[model samples]
Target chain A: MLILIVEDEKELALSIRDYLKGIQDITCDLAPNFSKAVELTELYSYDCLIVDLGLPDGDGLEIIKKVKTEDAQTGIIIISARDTLDDRLKGLNIGADDYLTKPFHLSELQARIASVLRRIRFDGKSILKEGVLEVDTVQRKIKVNGKEPDLTKSEFNILEYLITNKNKVVTKASIAEHILGEYSDMYSSYDFVYTHIKNLRKKLVELGCPDYIKTVYGTGYIFETA
Target chain B: MNLLTKTSLLITTVALTVLMAGGVIFFLSTKEMINKQVDKELISEMHFVMRSFDNLVHGRDTVFYEELTIIPTDEIISPVARFRDTIRLNVFDNKYHTYRALFFGFRKGGNNYKIEIFKSLIDSNTLIERVTLVWIGMSLFLIVAIYFLNKLIFKSTWKDFFEILKLAKSYDLKKPHKKVLLKESEINEFASLNTVITQLLERVERDFNNQKELTANTSHELQTPLSIIRMKAELLLQTPDLTSEQVRLISDILATTDRLSRLNKSLLTISKIENNQFRETEKISLHEKIRSLAGQFKELIDEKGLKISMTLEETTIEIHPLLADLLLVNLLGNAILHNPVENGRILLELKNNILKIANTGDHIELDKENIFHRYFRQSKNPGSTGIGLSIVKKICEYYDIDLDYRYRNNLHTFILDLSSLYTS
Candidate 1:
């Protein structure tokens, strides 16, 4: 999938581009200014566009509007330094798929990007599979080797987030934010993430599944598949 | 009393006092002058009668008239006239009337004679009464006229002042350049007041805009670099062959960056709230809000083995929804953050427009004065950002809610008095 990143901060844009490039199927194009963004959006079609509202030349919202008008199918996510509810509501009101504030976890961003893509492409019916493990994204059900394991809502969300950013280190903070909300960080406690992961790992291991989830001590959890 | 009413009352009192005193003095003086004139008339008439009697001394005896009476006496005395006021029955009107009389004894035709002449004071009394009635009527008219005239003058003079008050009451910093329809007044004070108020509003609006620009610039400038640093640290963690020490260092960097980002967001939220940017408000069921937040923090609560007891009544408040969420989250976060690690207790009670959250924590009381200040951390826990309570304070201030803290019965209690924002 080809994605467009429009950000005035060149280093931040490059980091996002490089981070999203970790996935084998994803390609990212960069636009450092509004005019360049508008030019690029007009030149090529993209599956999704990541936009920043504050640009040097013009408003990044205009690019989202233009891209949306040209192709309603293209997914749009606004990544802004402005975390105000007003801007978030305005971005969503303008038909953007999701809004993420700046200084976000790259893992969280990638999870959101994957979620948005899954929602648009398969209309929430997509199933992710790795060996004997299968997750039905639409029905929120998990299966391992033709058997089902009871998973709580939060565990399911955490599992999906980990699987989406599979092979990458997903911080406990990132998982909490993905499961709860952006403001959950202020709670400053990730013990719940540990508990849910513990239960999920026990359930999976009891169901004859290998231990695919690994803890990168003091950093975060990683979903390692061998 | 207001300025107009006070002035009118003072003027009326002084005018009535002066008018009453002047009326009484004028009536008395006029009565004395009229009595003196009557005495003079009576004395002149007595002289005329004596002169006429002298001319006809051998031809006429002593004459008797109602106004002039002459009587014969045996004793002879010097002739001297004296005046006396008398009340006599008038035959024509058949009523008692006041009279000024002059009496003298003289010797005529070798016989002693006395003569009395009287002048009635009826006309002078009538004149004084008419003058006094007219004075009273004129004074009444003058007082009434002055009162209304004073009111009219004050109303017109204060028109510009009232307009200025209205403009100030409706002043909004968001729309700083809104038209000011000020009515000019001839009074120097009011005109100068208008100029000063306009200048003040302009200055405030300029300051507000500057503050807003600073917040935005800070968000962009600071958050972008923080974002870069975090992303760099995150990328560094993904290196192909990293040692445990390197990972630990990277983790520290990420953690510190997260703290910095949270601090920046809190400061920005405070500035935004102070700027009155979150003007949208709606009625929120606080009972439901507390329950939802309690559910969200259930994991954190259970992990600490803390006992959370809730006593909530159906209460609603009008506030910005985001702020409402932030307020509850921060308060709940504090309760969980400051509680003891194991077997701690947290109690949430919402009753009668007051919300109380008590938790088992530090044995000593937190400083009441500085608890709500930014960066007031009671614990050495690195995870505590120390700005959560400040954010809560800012949100409460924005909605004009009263927040108080106390340590009693071995629990730290945060009491939020939400009566001002209570909609139900």
Candidate 2:
């Protein structure tokens, strides 16, 4: 998959570029300004674009609008520091597939990018599989080696969020945000996140799946298959 | 009373006093003048009779009253005249009428004789009554006319005052220029008032915008650096191999960065709210809101083994929905954040128009001095930005809701009186 990251901040753009390039199967390009973003979107036929809503030259929503008309199949994800609902709606309304707030885990951004790509190319499949653990999101079912695991709804959600952003550190707040809302980043408490994560790990271990969920000691949870 | 009414009262009091006093003085003086005329005529007749005393002595005796009898007195060293007021029977209607009479004593044909002369005073009485009636009618008309005149005159004269008032009331702080809203009054007092008010509003608006600018610039400028630090710490976590202590230290760094990011966002949110930037409002259910947040925090509640009771009735309020959600999150999130880890109790009740939230927490009172201040934390957690309650207070202030705090027996209660915001 080819992706374009349109962010003005040099360090943030470079970090995101490096992270995406290191994904092994994906190629990423960086644009530091709105004109460059427009120029790149016009010249290339990328599978997806990651945008920041606030850019020095122009708004990132304008780029989403420009690309959406040219190639409707290309997925777009908006990452912004202005996390208000109004800003989120505007990005979505302008044909962006997903939105992420800033100071977010790059892992969360990666998960959102993956989901957008899957929706475009994978026949919009709701099922996610990490090794022998498989989840049918539409049916809310979890299966392990042709057998189902007795996971509660809350436990299932936590597992799904963790596995989607696999191999990257996802904050407990991010997990809580998935369960709660965008405001959960501010309102998160450690105790509740630990309870959910603990139950999810216990359920997975009982089902004979590899212990994929790792705690980042005071940071958050990470799901990996190494 | 309003200015017009007050002025009319003072003017009317002075006017009535002067008119009433003038009427009394005129009535008395007019009566004296009439009496003088009557006395002069009586004295002239006495003079005519005295000059023609021989006539009264011989032929003019019939000019006296029908029952008059001349009396001789030894005490008449000189001729004397006196007047007295009396009631005399009206011959035509037999109603007693007021009469003022003059008596003159003189020596006639060597005998001291006295003659009493009276003119019926019915006309005088009628004249006095007519004068009094006119005076009373004029007093009422004069007072009433003065009130109405003041009402009409001041209303137009003070149009500029009302305009200034409206300008002051409707000035929007977010709008850059407001000098055009108020006009210079032609009246000196109001013009001075206009100048002073304009200067004051300009000063206040400048101060307010400076504060907003400082908050916005601080938050926005800090975001990129904070983002860089946070992303760098997050990137360092993906290191190939690190000791346990290194991982723990990096994790703490990440957590601190994350907390700092949230603090920046909170300051920005507060600045926007204080600027009244969120003018959009919608009707939303309070009960559903609290229920949804409770569901979100259920895990946290269970983790602490806290007992939370929520009794929500069906009620809705017209508010900026985002603000409403923030209010719920901060208040309830604080409840969860501050609850004791063991046997913590939280009760949320929506009774009447008040949202009463009580929780079991520190036995001693939280710092009451800076409880609602930003960054003045009450919890042991050093990461507390203390912006949560301040945000709650700001939202409450925006909606004009009354927020009260009470602590009793180790239970702190927050009551929000959104009484008037209820629509159903």
Candidate 3:
């Protein structure tokens, strides 16, 4: 899967690219500004697009609309540091799949992206099942030996994404962008992703689900069926 | 009701009263003196008649009567006769014998003889009537003269006064070079008044222009740096491989940008209030406004672990909402911001057209008089912009609202007298 991040912050874009590398078989591209972001959008097709609101040349919302218009099938999420309720409502009203305020956890972002993908591509159905380990995406219900186990929305989404993309590495940036949406701009420090991943892992282990989501140190996450 | 009309009316009333009173007194007293003179001459003629009759009767001389008749009686009685047509006389003998005497009187020598003489007072009355008529005519003429003189004084002086007044009313600061044209009056007071007014107008125009320019320049200067800071933050976010420290720095920049924006807005608000740019009327509920402000600041209050209590009486007050809001915001925000953390408590009470907000805080360091001065923040408080209380004071002054601040037992209380809301 390919993901494109068009942001004016070069450091933030690179960090996002680095985080995506941890996800197996996933590639990422970066665009540093409005003009460059526009160029990248025209030249590439991606599974998801992360767009920031403030751009060097123009407004980020304009770019998001243009990109969405160009590729209606692409899943777009807005990331903005502007936490005003009006800004959030406006971004959502303009067909953004999710709006994220700044200073958010990366794992939360990853869960959101997975959820969006499942909803759009897989019709929110988990196709990966092994014996007693069955993940239900539509209901966010997990079944171990035909006994349903309770899961939070974040936990269920995290488990489902890891299982669907088994034997692959998912970077912290991808996860952060997915859950935190545009808010990752505020958390450019990249430390919040560790806590959310840690929590998700601890929950999955306690539930007796397969422990496949792994932290690739200094990079991202990897889910293995071993 | 205008000054000129009022003053001139008063002058006319007083002048007319004095002139008419003097005219009446002069007419009455002059008539009395003329009557007294007529009475005195009549008495002297009566005496002369008695003496002449006595001589004639005693000497038994018929020549005395003839001599008296040749004495030109017109001279002796003309003054009285001029006022009367005829003079009548009566003579009484010792046995009460009576004779009708004309012009003069005669009497017997040994036998007691009494003589009485009277000139016709009808002519005297006629003369007195003529004199009164002339006196009244002269008085009328004098009153007319005095009235015209008063009118002349009022006309010249009032014209100049009105001209100065018109110039003052039409004075425009935008056209400072246009001099108020006043015809120079000989009256020193009016001339001096004109000079003073012209000087005052010039000074006012100068000060107004200077203030406008200062505000314009200050606003421009502040806005420029604010814009630059915002743009710089946006640009900084675009840098590659930014460390965690760099990210933190950018966040700081953004926060400062927000503060600067707020400052700019507050300054603009103060300027607007100072210039009286807002309309003077609005209907607002003081209770509802305080409730709304409390709700808005609820989070900050909660975060500081402060307990807030409110007791508001139901009342609908009318005032300018902008000024009222500004006043409330500053007072409440100040109370919240200055209070000690965890120990902070606010008591908001509104009743009897008074709003009192009290909060726990450090003791006020400065004298109360300096509290409302611009940029006069209390010592040892770093977070305050100092302009908040000043803005509150200005709003109170403009709306004629009374604001009082007091500190007691580590509690700072601000009282807003909303009495003007009802009266205005």
For each candidate, what is the lDDT?
0.85, 0.80, 0.64
Q: Quote fnat for model 1.
A: 0.69
Docking class of 2: acceptable
lDDT of 2 by residue, B276-380 (tens): 777788888888989988887876777778999989888889888888988988898888878888989999999777898899998977766678888878776
Candidate 2 lDDT by residue in tens digits, A79-173: 98887789989889999999888877776677788778877776746788777888887688899877897887778877877777677777766
Ranking by lDDT: 1, 2, 3
Residues B274-368 of candidate 1: C-alpha lDDT, one tens digit per residue: 66678888999999999999998877787788899999999989999989988988888888888888779999999999999999998988988
**How many angstroms is residue B151 displaced in model 1 relative to the true structure, after the best TM-score fit?**
16
- Cα error, candidate 2, residue A214 (Å): 2.9
Model 2 spans with C-alpha error above 4 angstroms: A123-127, A185-188, B1-184, B365-370
Of 2 and 3, which scores higher on lDDT?
2
Instruction: For model 1, report DockQ.
Output: 0.51
Estimate, for each residue in B124-230, the C-alpha lDDT of model 3 and write its tens digit.
45665787678667766766676667677778767877777787787755444455666576778879998898778768867886786577457645653554454
Give the winner by DockQ: 2 or 3: 2
Cα RMSD for predicted model 1 = 7.1
